[model samples]
Target: MKRLYRALLWLFPPGYRLAFGDEMTAVFEALARDRRRRGKAVYLEFLLTESITLIAGAVLEWIEKAAGREYPADVAAARRAETDVSVPAEIIEARQRVTTLVSLMTDAISRYDYKRARFYSLAEERERRRLRALETGQA
Candidate 1:
């Protein structure tokens, strides 16, 4: 069950994953805890639905990125791996899950995810160069 969650999260681009992995897991854990207080049936349903939705939403964003000329491989795998499951019925269900997860993901992407990744990568490179400079003590 947790593997499903992990598989779904694999859709996030590495940088986005690094930024939001813990936060998303926390949210999932809290949701699971609340459901446990309710019932096993509900908890199971929540797990299945959330896993599907979160993964589907990540797939959508991966498509969006690919369209924008960014090849997000990890994200892409989450989508392509299940190509045969693209029938209309499954798609409709996936779409519903995607709707909820997409809302949160979109919000995160806009708020901090994408920008932070880009900034982090740049800053990391700068730091590495600085370290090298310190070692060399010359341009």
Candidate 2:
């Protein structure tokens, strides 16, 4: 029941789970309870939907991991493909940033706590400023 749902959640990307994991589980539990009141089939429908989302959410991580993997290049064609077909490093960095935000937002969204993201963002900005001030010896 709930255990199975919890286990299925592990299929989601790590970034996603880092942010929204527990909140989503709580949500699923609530939904499951509601569905149980309705019928087991209704609960099953919810479970299926969750499984699909978990798999889909994992795709972003998989893509990034695949892109980062170093492939064997014994074949000349492999080397050419590696050199010729690729995303720019900037795009890869941007993707990494987006993954971070996605994880943060997911956590905030699941917690029903928008302020966590906002506060963290502001804190980061403040810390950057403070570091700059420190570097300049300006307190």
Candidate 3:
């Protein structure tokens, strides 16, 4: 059951899984065990419900990711900073670009496209370095 649960987790977006997979798995395991204590019927019901919900959640998350509706931690912080009138638009735009590159890398990895993933990884790193250099007045 745990193995099946782990396999089903692959349906989730890579970033979402990276952020919450272990914790979600742990919680699922605990709930499964507790439900089993009631009866086979109860346990089966719990498993079915959980599995369906997980699949639905994964679909929604993928939609959000594809639509650019989700943001990474750093990007979200940068977006929040945009609310400040003093923050430069260029910085916010750069942060958003980095976030997009990261999302592309994760998507590539999820699809088992290592070459594309490597390219995006390098691109993201270069962008981050450029941002840092700009901050330090070296670029």
11-129, model 2: which lDDT tens digit per residue? 44434454566787898888878887888788778778877876776655445433453223213332342354364444334334444554565566557797886865565445545
Give the per-residue lDDT digits (tens) of candidate 1, residues 1-139.
5555665675554434545666888788888889988998998889888977887876665556544544465345434533535434444344334433444445555667876546544544454455344434553
The per-model lDDT (C-alpha) reads: 0.57, 0.56, 0.76
For model 2, what is the error of residue 134's alpha carbon versus the real structure, in angstroms, after optimal superposition?
Answer: 42
Candidate 2 lowest-lDDT run of ten: 70-79
**Residue 78 miss distance in model 3 (angstroms):** 18
lDDT of 1 at 90: 43
Across 1-139, the per-residue lDDT of candidate 3 in tens digits comes to 9888976875665556656778889999999989999999999999999899989997688668766776585245444555656756666576567767877877897799999999998998788777656656687
Kindly give the number of clashing pairs for every candidate. 0, 1, 0
- Report how far off residue 89 is in candidate 1 (Å): 44
* Candidate 3 accuracy as TM-score: 0.52
User: Could you tell me the lDDT of residue 42 within candidate 1?
Assistant: 95
The true-versus-predicted C-alpha distance at residue 102 of model 1, in Å, is 20
TM-score-superior candidate, 1 or 3:
3
Candidate 1 lDDT = 0.57
* Candidate 2 accuracy as TM-score: 0.40
What's each prediction's TM-score?
Answer: 0.44, 0.40, 0.52
**Residue 59 of model 1, lDDT score:** 66
Q: List the residue pairs that clash in candidate 3.
A: none
> For model 2, what is the error of residue 104's alpha carbon versus the real structure, in angstroms, after optimal superposition?
24
